[model samples]
Target: MSSTGIEIERAAGFVKNETPQIVTSRFDVEDSHTLVGYLATGGYEGIRKALTQTPAEVHGEIRDATVLGRGGAGFPAGVKWGFMPPDVFPRYLVVNGDESEPGTYKDRLLMELDPHQLIEGCLIASYAVGLSQCFLYVRGEMALAQERIATALNEAYAAGYVGRNILGTDFSLDIILHWGAGAYVVGEETALIESLEGNRGMPRLKPPYFPAAIGLYGKPTIVNNVETLANLPWIANNGAEEYRKIGTETSPGTRMVAVSGHVKRPGVYEIINGTTTFRQLLFDEEYCGGMLEGRTLKAFVPGGGSAPWFLPDQLDLPFEASEVGPAGSMLGSGAIMVMDDTTDIPKAAHSLTRFYAHESCGKCVPCREGGTWLERILGRIIDGHGTTRDLAMLLEVGETICPGDFPHASSERLGLDAQRFPYQMTTICFVGPSAFAPIHSALTLFPEEFAERVRDVTDEELAASAVGAVPVELKGVAAQ
Candidate 1:
């Protein structure tokens, strides 16, 4: 049977995250992050283990711990690491430092505060994946992060953590830095790896397969997210079981949740695995401050931008992968976008669809063309172009491109008819379907918004720009 998802089987005393625990590497908002500071906090301990232990031992430790990628696709980190061939001569460890997921900000906080935590994580990842060379592919907009990491890398090198035959075990590595021009899809592991190889940063097909088998110039490579790598030192220093002691059986270790929208404290907070509850966040942690005084909770994007959004009634479900997937969503990047009663769910989803439309890499026709077409259709509908049948039509078309399709191909589909297709793709059910949920739910939940639209829809005069007549947001922010 397939792995459904992860849930908290038997978690004891709940750990409410009132503030960020600040582990691994700590970045001070206004203070200095010197080399001494990182070393002082027990940094580079993972690297020390890697230098002393065998690759098999390191692999077993990671596999036993159940650490998944912190990016959208929560693939097993150890499994990805084990796929690398021992005698591949040379391999690569590519770190995805791009934090373009709309609602996510955990990695940014980590990079801003403790750049070396990531560097040290990359070193351990490199050692485990059997690569002496690695690269941190950051987004172009993160100039300050680039500077901070650059300085940290130099400091690491000066201390002999990186470079030739050092750490006294003959294992040496150097991590290079690269930047993306800009694109949300670049966060995908394959796309980032492609970008590092100096391409357009579009994702490639699997099973020609995962990067751990063959990546970066047609050699074996293991691409991991910055946050995933950040936990390496902690995992090594404390044992695998210690890390496992936190999260659920399937999803172990703490997660830095980035809370945004309709919240009093709209920032990143570190919560122990399976310890924090959704209600605790709103009522206890006071991040949401209890839904804008009078308004009830509308919905929330459980993950970051690409994940599904849920209604207020479903708040009691566990936020782990198991609980989330069974409930028709995924714990994407732990970027919880809580929407209050005032927010229009459809309009919010449309706003997200627009982002996906702009950021979609044109590798496959479905994600590229389908996303664009959906945005246009949604744009017209949101701009008072609805006539009642649009909702069913939207859901239908979502299924068409979800498994994806080229002129004559698709992403991970099985056959012409969806019946032959996997249950996962056929329903158009997970996150992509969720992109439509907010809008669909809103049309029913907040009929007043649409009634106002049907009665008072009007176009203003602003046609004297280079981009022609474009749609504007509900709050009047034009879609340019």
Candidate 2:
């Protein structure tokens, strides 16, 4: 028996016979980040193989593999490559390494430990897509990661692995390392492009400004996540069929998962994509090794902080998008955060809302104003001056961001049936919805916690207690 009272079913095939170490294969090697060490471990072999094949052939292999973007959106990587306008010159590849999503640190580990692998992956992607130039946008806070990649870029260029006729072939490419200013909003593709062009890092509306069609410098571009690009070298080297054998049919190959919070061992683990369940990840000794001592599982964020929280009942679901998405959350960014029974639900929700509130970019009105509003209300409830009306207002404010049936776990208190995820949103990007995710999950999953924290406080008391007075829009909901 584990700490959560769940049986440790080690005999079951939840644990694969041989775990596939795709991107993380070189992590344990001491000098894996160095060009010499990376070369010894079959680093640039994928790009070498890629250069031998035609661009279309290389693209075909990746497309056949169906490598889903390891970034939050989980879109197909090869398909994204094909989105470039035919015969368009100066096509660009922007690598998203701005990993600011809370509870998501897998991309940072990849950049810091095996930068050469990421470079090789970048080489493969640029070659396959006929991209003239590549930009690696790393988060500013990751000084070690930026240093490692910059040094690796210099070594790669000197070794002829980058810049003009790579490995003595007709193919030529240039990879540039660009640092981000540690803004969470730039994690969005277009916003990253905006920052790269020396503008404010705020997302551009879709349709008129899809990155693949009209991206950086008003030309065709492909923006891929660090982990998503990192997988290309492996797929190019092993072939698509070999990669498919590792994980399930839809989500082929392994994914790096960063498990944290109240777990015995909380670190990055590359697991077989669809085969690994939350229970296997959280409780399996090879993964997180169950929760901390004396901590029974209460709830966990299935993806990053933005994903809707999952109760203990959903633990058996696999870490696949198909499985987790229908269950009212997503396996976004491959980050799993565990919370124990002792966690204060209202206070915890307040913390997440506070992050989204602070990081709003002030581009979208709903996200800028509504996110801050949601945070203040949660804060007020946590400080013990909430009313029953305040709970209703949380859902109402959430509805303004994500309209019509907010994605939530089944709640007996609210007499609500479980709603599925990918909630309908009124905002431009997911930032507004991200702010509401924790509030909806907390109120729906554990209404009693909020109820216990609330008193029949007068309107003046509520106003006095809150950091920001409740907005007029929310004030209307509270009155009702």
Candidate 3:
């Protein structure tokens, strides 16, 4: 057995059968993308079964299952559906296929492999909410996924399963496929809605413009991620109780995690939420098969690029949101990026800071200014022109630009009732915090790397640099 209690011999011989294949069941199957092959695997059965029951029944079953949103936030999916206003006409449903987060590619694979499943999930969601038409906002770079889904949509419409009395029932719906212009901020639901309406992809304020109350052409709307809707069929067919047994009591069902960065085998793997630890995920041959070139683990991004990275000590923790949240991080987008000892932490932080700076929509002051300053400061550090004061400046600027509040669900099972701080959101959207997460975490987790780049500055130099309040205790800043 390896250090993590996983049998090395067993992991070495691991096959696809070792793990529960929920979302990636079709990965090994031939012709899985075609309509005929999808039907052979009992596709569209969920919507067919859903049409027999009332919309409320479908919603209740999902709520009982406790399937949280797979897109970064970890909010409960059923609760979001319930927020739609009652007796409201022209309600809309949108599938957020705009996956622009770095190191996260699970949604793109799901769409390419099982477009039929997504279409069926979309149909069930539309029925539950009385939405006559639904739109799928796919990432523009994913041309292959777009082609496959477009083909599947044509097949479903021809078979009378998509448009006009689906499966001979009164519930008729239409599904439209739209491509995005590759803006990271457009991944935000309201911003995606704004872009869908032929406008710039900038986020709208809350309260009056909440997507549940007012969205997409000023109507009630529910914007769900692609992975969230894909799970509906399994819940609809197998019942909520059965689905709950797959994962932990708090976060049930399997989720696809995309593993990237310095690893021997970097790809996507589906694991039951909270059941697998970061240690097993990294060392076990079934997953990443340990680090590349036999190097020791140094640090890793626990979630997506927007999430704070975790050190080796936190490796025993589960990959679920409930476990990672209280530990001062989140399971954002379920993308784990592993880094080895040879990596330069300061250089990496600068690279990610550049991404957020370029992706900022420039809608609000905090995000725009904060992102630009972060990029420039990190750039200076990488070029060996930074001072020790730059470290405090990074954290201070991050706090000023965005609140470091953890992402939580509206429900108790998924979030905490106790408030961390008085609700003080400075920006229009989460882009500010998203930009700051890596920069702040990099400094906190790998201080030695930052300290190495910091030059020895005289006391007079510190005052001249406008860092008069810089701590006098710091090594060279006080005096010789």
Candidate 4:
């Protein structure tokens, strides 16, 4: 494993050791984005090695490595690549670069610092999946990243590594870099595919219509994250066993973590999965070098904005999906958003809820209406007009939208049958859950902050409002 090589200064006037360098080893290297620079540092060796092996062999190695998608879902990438139907013609690969998830910027780092590495990874992925062309969908706002990738693509094509018999082999592939309209929902694989097809970005229904079987003009396709694809070259160059030995047995290899908010050193840091703790990420001299301004750590978003928040009590937990998931959150996108004690949880929840509300595509009623209501309620709470009943309503709306087992809302408490409540399978996509995770987490973890904003109301008045009872002044006025 390569070391970070640089020293990080902490807020406490101390220098922290550099972190591990796997995905980000080339980040600080001069001219790292260029083909020549990448070639000098053992670049394109993965494809050169991969070209000698068959597609099945490539897929087998990836499966053996257990490379999960780095794009928030943590789905197994090798298995996803194998989902493509056999003997299919004109299969395509789409690289999701819509890094719009709040607090997540790891993908953008790879694209900006190592475009050639991404291209080689894409080529290796295409070769493994028997693809002829790959589409790189970058966020429209990322001009520099797009420019870097475009230049690299042009260079690859000129070198005969992109089109028409790549590297003197019968295999041929083309890469197209497309920009998005800056929609967060487009980060979804199906929504991204829809946008790539010139349609409004909206997620497609699953089952018989999954992307692997039907994607990109209705042909077999495989969609992968930029970081996920970048790892292919590493696994291709070094065997899976060596790669698997670095991190935890289940989630192997190093992952790029984008640490932001209240950190002494807020930037991208690469760490072996399941090997580092959130506490070390926040306080250890080698990582973030402790919190900013000597502020005590209150809570943190373990994954991206969509993932649930974690209290300081969970600080010792490893930064891995398996551990975080069992602890009531996930390692979504590996985005660590640290919040200091002085931060206002309710107000922060309101801001994030409003973002999701504004970004809702309105294709699904649950997400559209639910996100709007969540933001509005949180806004009212933040504005100092919330009621105790509003807290119950917040949990209810989140449950109705996402259909999860909300621990606060027991079936017996509502006097309703468990089977009758829509608490297990709710929305059309994961957006509903994403929109509510932070809200539910805020309400669950920081009840005192929310309670401080709650307005006092009589039981009679609250019950009257619950049943939509009209005010005495407005009741007769409406009729008149």
**Per-residue lDDT tens digits of candidate 1, residues 1-480?**
115232223311112344434242354423435677777777777778666788668768878888878876788898878777778857888888888887888776667668887887887777766786888888888988888888888887888887776577677888787888887667877777778778887777755567776788888888888888888878778769888878678777777777776655555667765656777666554444455445577677777776655666557766577666655556778888888777765578689888877776766665666677767777777788763445545655665655342111111222221111112333211333334434443443445565555433234423322355553443256432
Give the least accurate 10-residue stretch of model 1, judged by summed lDDT. 406-415
Candidate 3 per-residue lDDT, tens place, 1-480, comes to 447432333322113536777677776677988999999998988998988899989888888888889887878888888888899979999899999787897899889989998999899888887886899999988999999999999999999889997888888888999999779999988999999998999998876635988998899888989999999988899999999999898888988888777777777888878789988888898788888765888788877888766777678889776667766667879888888888888888777888888899999888899989998988988898888878888878888876555332122322323222112458887787777777876776667789988987767776755765645556576676
Candidate 4 per-residue lDDT, tens place, 308-370, comes to 777777788886766666566678788888888888999888777787888888888889999
Weakest 10 consecutive residues, lDDT, candidate 4?
Answer: 413-422
Evaluate model 3: give its lDDT: 0.81
Residue 103 CA displacement from its true place in model 2, Å: 0.2
Collision pairs in model 2: none
Q: Which should have the higher TM-score, number 2 or number 4?
A: 2
TM-score of 1: 0.81
Model 4 residue 252 CA deviation in Å: 0.6
TM-score of 2: 0.91
Clashing pairs in 4: none
lDDT of 2 by residue, 139-170 (tens): 99999999999999999999999998889998
Residue pairs that clash (backbone atoms under 3 angstroms), model 3: none
Q: Evaluated with lDDT, which candidate comes out highest?
A: 2
Give the count of colliding residue pairs in each prediction.
5, 0, 0, 0
> Could you tell me the lDDT of residue 21 within candidate 2?
84
The runs of at least 3 residues in candidate 2 whose Cα sits more than 4 Å from the true structure, single-residue gaps closed, are 1-18, 411-416, 457-480
- Which candidate model has the greater lDDT, 2 or 3? 2
